[model samples]
Target: MGGPVERPVPEDSAPEQSAADVAPVTVGQGSVDSPSGVERHGMFGVAGSGDTSGFGGLVREPWTAPGAQRPYGSYFDEIVDGLYEAYADAAAAITKVVVERNELTLHIAREHLIGVATALRNDPSLRFELCSSVSGVDYLGSTHRLHSVAHLTSMTYRRRVRLEVSVSVDDPHLPSLTGLYPGTDWQERETYDMFGIIYDGHPSLTRILMPDDWDGHPQRKDYPLGGVPIQYKGATIPPPDERRAYK
Candidate 1:
């Protein structure tokens, strides 16, 4: 299963790449009625009338990386093809493939994240053996507000890819990748601690940064802004904007 698959010499290595080597990977046609990008209204995206930024008149269209078209350039096509070869159900597992800003991201269903990740890692052609980082994104107002993203590297092929999964806030659950990549243990915990994502199969998915009694996940887009009082060593401390005693 770990056999080495020859990589087409990248354009940089050779004067040019052959037509077959640069062929577009046709896996993962786009889905979802709406783009998964975040939508914003007003300068500060203010819900209430506190338009302190004063640029409130400006409205920004959601800039999203829509499902990518064929021939995802670079080694991306190879990676996609390899994943399909390794994973029997690649089509069902992946929601969409987004290649934008010179990067490739595979949005997988949360239920199939592990299997897809496994295929990426074990397949010699795909060889995304290392899960270097795991993090989260909260796209407020989207149907699936929480997104768990993982970055992987293929040491053998000098390639990298991103795997992302989204779940609704009401049921924010995703399988932990610690069993696959031990380093993901703390990264997943930190994501959970900051974003409140519950990693279902995590062995010890406790609060890694926030105190156990902390009121809410601090990093979520919907988390309250820092304007409340804080208790430190049994003494009251004013919020940042209200603080003036240091003078």
Candidate 2:
């Protein structure tokens, strides 16, 4: 009883954080954090030309942002709580939550899109009644290449949040949100046209920006650069939207 007894815990008995619980992040001194969990080889400069400038030799590895820690500042905590209270499978539905640049984004699984959307819209405390926009992105290097994003707005609470769902290019399908937010009809269509993300229950998933028989998604990273040339350097080019045959 001199002062206090200290004991050393065996390394085997001590608690250890598993890799699953770890959220990886890369922070630069004065640069923005991208927070995507994918790495890719990228060329910095000299597009379609030999490396005369040497800038093309450089590869940029953008920082990957970390998942939000507990007690997310501002009303993010309340929003999360409300979602948990409203959705029975909230834990499984919410794949990850990231707070960055003063915005809240919830990465949701595609399977639970409707359930989470319903909860966010109908639940009083988490009344995300409006989906301002629905967009698609191709994180080319990631396992899930296609990403569908919806920006939600709460008119009553004046809060805005984002929901993202990702799926592999081989099996790209997400349930439509037009049933919940009618405004997302054309937005989802445009996204489908641009990135080829098929909204499963969409009223009309036809291409909005391109012809019905358009070949591939124009905005995708792997899409060939074949569109009409706009006299960039007096270079003659062919159109990219060559009709594609559907099986």
Candidate 3:
């Protein structure tokens, strides 16, 4: 048919701004759309000042991971092939596969976590026996703000792989891996305690590090850093907000 579409690139003469100089950007509501259809929200650099420092010319673009191409090299290819063959019925669950820094990470859909995990552990060819760790990450700006990471280890093959699942903060529910790996019991609790991700089938999912009445998930980026002021030897020490601060 026709030739491929070409996109225009910004000129070098255009001003740039550093990430630190950029204000927090909210998407979709008031964001400005570029000619290429990418949304640009929030201003960078000093609002009303002229650039004198070299860093003032730096602009920050959105962060995204590039797709990895096959042959993925080494055992990564075998693992993917095995997984695909084993979970052929649930193919949609495996969203993306990434190979970075000699590691393989599978970005899985939240709803398919349990099924994928089960397949990884039981399939003879892909015997990922151990669920080493479970952790959480809050991607501050994206639509899927909460991410749960599960590190899997194959004791039989001496290999490791990571499984990642992303969900919206509004409905942070994931299928608990406790049924597949009992060690994940406490780890899941700890993640829920700090990141507010609710593992639906976790047994006794409660505060592991924080007190039972803790107000918020402490590790989330949007969580407040300071709480009530500390009292030392009957003297009042103000909370972080009341103390002197520097930008």
- On lDDT, the leading prediction is 1
Weakest lDDT window of 10 consecutive positions for candidate 2: 24-33
User: How many clashes in each candidate?
Assistant: 1, 3, 4
- The list of candidate 2 runs beyond 4 A from truth reads 1-57, 227-247
TM-score to true structure, per model: 0.75, 0.73, 0.72
Q: Estimate the TM-score for candidate 3.
A: 0.72
Q: How does candidate 1 fare on TM-score?
A: 0.75
Better by lDDT, candidate 3 or 1:
1
lDDT of 2 by residue, 104-177 (tens): 99988766778888778877777776888889877776556678989999876888999987776777777888
**Among all candidates shown, the one with the greatest TM-score:** 1
Per-model CA lDDT versus the true structure: 0.73, 0.72, 0.70
Across 38-136, the per-residue lDDT of candidate 1 in tens digits comes to 554554444565666666666666655678978999889988888888888788777788898788999887666777887787765777868889999
RMSD of 1: 10.4
How many Å off is the CA of 206 in candidate 1?
A: 0.3
The ten-residue window of minimal lDDT in model 1 covers 14-23
